[model samples]
Structure formats: structure tokens, C-alpha cells
Target: MRALTAAAIGLAAALALVLAMTAVGAPSGETSPEPLLTTVPKHP
Candidate 1:
């Protein structure tokens, strides 16, 4: 039971670390402005 508890805690810590890293390393929406500007039609 103790081992299982430790394993679960470790897994949770690892998942949190991965999520934090991804959130930090991911690109911001402002990085790409062309797509947002060009997606709409120029003419009616």
C-alpha cells in the first residue's frame, strides 16, 4: 500500500511537470498574425 501511494504521487508530479513545461514552451497566439488576418475573404 505504501509503494502504491508513492507511485501515484510520483505519477502525479511527473504529469504536472510535463504540463507546466508544455505550457511554458508552447507558442503564443500573437506569434502568428497572418493566418488570423488572411482567413477572411477580401471581397464580398
Candidate 2:
């Protein structure tokens, strides 16, 4: 029981740390560039 409780706490702490770091970090909401689905032939 003790081990399980400790493991849960550790997991929660790691998650919280990641959340906190992201909260104060750079904006990660930048839109991804549209995928180039097709390639065009190059002219010589």
C-alpha cells in the first residue's frame, strides 16, 4: 500500500511539474504548416 501511494504521488508530481513548466514556457499553440501533399515538376 505504501509503495503504491508513493508511486502515485511521484506520478502526480511529475505531471504537475510538466504542466507548470509548460504554463510559463513559450506558446506551443502555433499552427502547423499545411502539408504539401503534392510536388510540382521543376522547369529547366
Instruction: Note the clash tally of each candidate.
Output: 0, 0
Q: What is the C-alpha lDDT profile of model 1 across 1-44, one tens digit per residue?
A: 99999999999999999999988897656565555555666786
Best by lDDT: 2
lDDT of 2 at 20: 100
Predicted structure 2: clash tally:
0
RMSD of every prediction: 6.7, 5.7
RMSD of 2: 5.7
Prediction 1 TM-score vs. true = 0.56
List clashing residue pairs in candidate 2.
none
Model 1 Cα shift for residue 1 (angstroms): 0.3
Scored by lDDT, model 1 comes in at: 0.86
The residue-level lDDT of candidate 1 at 41 comes to: 67
